[model samples]
Target chain A: MQGRTRNIYLIPYMLWIVLFVVAPIALIMYYSMFNIDGAWSLENYRRFFTPVYLSMTLRSFWYAILITGFALLIAYPTAYLLTKTEHKQLWLMLIILPSWINLLLKVYAFIGILGFYGPINSFLRIIGIGSRQILFTGFSFIFVAVYIFIPYMILPVFNALEELNPSLVDAARDLGASPWATFRRVIFPLTVSGVKAGCRAVFIPALSLFMITRLIAGNRVITLGTAIEQHFLVTQDWGMGSTIAVFLIIAMGLTMIMTENGKLVK
Target chain B: MKKVMQMFITVVIAALGLMYLTFVLNSQQGYSGGNTLTVYNWGDYIDPELITKFQQETGIKIIYQTFDSNEAMLTKIAQGGTSFDVAIPSDYAISKMKEQGLLIPLDHCKIPNLKYIDPRFLDLPFDENNEYSAPYFWGTLGIIYNPEILEGMEFTSWNDLWDERLRNEILLYDSAREVIGMGLNSLHYSLNDTDIDHLMEAKRKLDALSPNIKAIVGDEVKMLLANEEAAIGVVWSGDASEIIGANDKLDYVIPDEGTNIWFDNIVIPAGAKNVEGAHLFINFMLDPENAAQNTEYVGYSTPNMKALEYLPEEITGDVRFYPGSDITDKFELYENLGKKMTAYYNELFLEFKMHRK
Candidate 1:
């Protein structure tokens, strides 16, 4: 009877996975086999392997790496520092509050904040640095992406840090290990799962961001996501779009495997 | 074993139930011989009051939907799911739809207000004899610049955009055809030139002007230009008028090398369920007073010549928005480049953008 009840409970979740996840991926793979005119062909796959697409894939990977690296660099320290604070939970909530606002609204705000006449420019002029074009640059793109993703990065690391037992650090210190040595050897290893989790959370989405590239990067940057959008919407080439998406899914699976906790921990 | 069999039967029954529910809901939303008209148009393209007035005058419920791009609109209608009664697509899109047999022929007898439209807009190459579409609004691509920021500099032709003084001061519209067309026009070639060598030359010409180019953007070009963030912006004549309206210091001009004159027309999809209601809506919009009101609110050039009497002189008399034949005679409409060529243009444009970084 218990087994039957468990089976009944699993049915809805299995249905959701089949309907939303598995089915769509299968459709994309099926579509990827066709050419623009709906003829069965390998043209899309051949086109994807060309230099133009290869470079874009490389560029997209590079951007995703930079964004993930920056998010981790900022978030790890912030999360670590928050654990040492008195109102840690409140501070974490405050950090997460901005994310609750609509993403497009936040991006638009950055456009103004980074504009020629924005506060940052005014400050620069006051300090004799003078105004410069801050928006639409690669620097601005990475900056805005990291800012948006920092909360996701921080949450996972924060939870990992909170779950950590203090006696482990004390045991290291008690054994004559220096603070740096203790962290490198003890605390970090235990929290490696959280760091992997944060990276996974940030990197995959960064690979496929389209709107930020359009509004913040000024079309100067084209990620795999933007190319997919262009092909699917502007050119109405579903086959090519699906081909890019198939590669993206494969890349994501590889990222997950690389970040898997059990394998890395062992 | 009996328990496992029972579980499998339950799962199959649940799946069937879900599928049946979906089918029922979909059918409910499908066209069912109602006095309802589904209008799919660009967002904020029509005045809200006009829709209300139309609904009141005809007693037919209006189900208005908006799409941001022509391709998106075409995809939805082509999918053959929802039956959109009326759609407003641009010139090239109309041609593409007609070729695909996705549009229905317009019944002239039902749309008497078509007589009020300027004769020049009729019998166009895209919809010869107004078979599949009717002119709604038309505009030219031009330059909008802040005179103060430009100082004594002037943009008389497309070549002026490349002047060294405008370094990082020009905002190019983030559209493939229009920007590439500017390059072609500057080189005295047709905007629709499909020759590979000419296109390569145009791309090369555009590459040299990259230093002067600021951010290539979309609708935000209006806000950026109005705020004087850039000295010059290449935009549609309607957008130029809106920018000028926001900042009187700004001025608009049509480059002497000629430019693309585009049109948006009301077209009924082939799968329309309320074809008569769609005709009624189109005719109501084309009426002189209604068209004038729409033009004043939407700030695009009205194709209804008779509507000029109802419009303010400031709007109708402005040659920038309503240029004479002397200027318009040189303008060209974008031809429906086939799928391969269209994709090629997009690829070249993408290469040009990637070249910027």
Candidate 2:
């Protein structure tokens, strides 16, 4: 009776998940299998396999990987350092401060910082390099993407690091292991969940980002996100858009499963 | 205990059911009252004060909403979720709406002020008989250039966009039609050509023009060009008007090769809940004084014949605004291509963008 009563608390949330989440995914799968005329065919998915579109998918994966890698590299150290600090809450707040601003505002702020006559160029000109275009480069695209998505990477890892058992490291050191080996064999292995969690958190959104690619990257980055926008918004081809979205959805599910696999390993 | 659990589940379900009921009811409702008019238009496309004036004169309240793109507006209307009495879609979009039977023929008797609309804006291919649409604002695709970059070099033709010296110094329109249309016009072809071969040629021309173009941009082109990030930007005349207002070095020209002329016109959709209120609103907007105020505030030229008398000569004399100077013969209107052909254009546009990457 007690367990049944507790299960009742989940009904509202389950209803929401059904209405907003599961329903939309089902609708997208339905749309992906049919044309605008409601005729069922594999044409939409076939279009995704064409050479040009295949390249876009690859490009999306490439950018997503780089974003995840950089985010993990930067966030691990910051999160590890935060675990040693007294005011973890204050430090986390400072780390996530920029994300509190609206995304578009953050993008514009990046533009102002990296534009042709922006502060970066002005400072460079003072050092005699002359003004150069930085706002629309590939560097700016990845930099802004990492900037926007780093917070997601940090919080999970920070929690994992905070909850880490310290006696295990001391035990490994007491067992005649060097400090380096202690960290390599004990601490790092224990934090795999956090690293996996951080990667899962950062990689999925990075794969499908549309606005940052357009604003900071100029029209150069041809990722899956922009292709979906063109089909859905510009071309009004909902079927193709849904097809790409279905792929992205599957990719996200697989990523989540991979993180689950990491948890099961322990 | 079983009875308590069942009762708890029932209460939770009832609460959720109430929330869902409210959501469904609120998604749509009859206009606030019989006299309320729901107007859907582009963002910043109208003068807000004119809406207040219309309400004061007619005692009809308006619920105004804005959409950023015609595609978004079309999708909303086609879904039949919202019933808007008045909507402003561009020329090709209005034609698409008409073909889909989403629009109702305007009752001419209700819009008696239609006589004040410019004849040049009437009887065009989109609505040849003026049966469905009335022009609200129109402009041409043109280039806004910095005199500092093109000093003593006349930017009188499309070839100027391809100047070798302009490499990485140009911003093209992000729109597929305008970008591909310029390529068509450069080869002396129609802007609305759906021929596969012609489009292939246009694709080739665009590929060649790629080295010069820094980016294909939308509304951001205004701020970018004004800030001198690019030497030239392809944009609508009204955007150029706003851009030139901000930056002294900038000037606009509709190149002699040809250009797409577009109009945003008002229409009543078939599912409109208040047709009478919509017609009244349209006619009120056509009134000369109201049109002139809209023209001044929106910074786009009006089609009201009598509104010109009230506009300052700066607008009247600006060749980009009035379109009386040169290239009148080169005015081309974008026609609504059927779904299959539209897919072709979209495919080619995607290929072009992919090729750039």
lDDT of 2 by residue, A1-266 (tens): 78987887788789999999999999999989977555899899888899978988988999999999999999998998998899989999999898889999989888779988889999999999898878777788999999998999999888887778888877898899997897778877888888898898899999999888778887777788988888887777888889999999998998888778747224
In the range A1-266, model 1's lDDT, one tens digit per residue, is: 99988887798899999999999999999999988888999999999998788999999999999999999999999999999999998999999999999999999999899999989999999999999998888999999999999999999999988988999999999999999999999989889889999999999999999899988888878889988988887777899999999999999999999999373342
Off by over 4 Å in 2: A1-14, A36-38, A170-182, A262-266, B1-32, B80-82, B150-152
Q: What TM-score number comes out for model 2?
A: 0.90
lDDT of 1 at B296: 88
Q: What is the lDDT of residue A201 in candidate 1?
A: 98
| Candidate whose lDDT is highest | 1
User: By summed lDDT, which 10 consecutive residues of candidate 1 chain B come out lowest?
Assistant: B25-34
Count of clashes in candidate 1: 0
RMSD of 2: 4.0
True contacts kept of each: 0.47, 0.51
Best by DockQ: 2
Candidate 1 lDDT at A52 equals 82
Error of 1 at B24 (Å): 18
Question: Candidate 2 — which pairs collide?
Answer: none
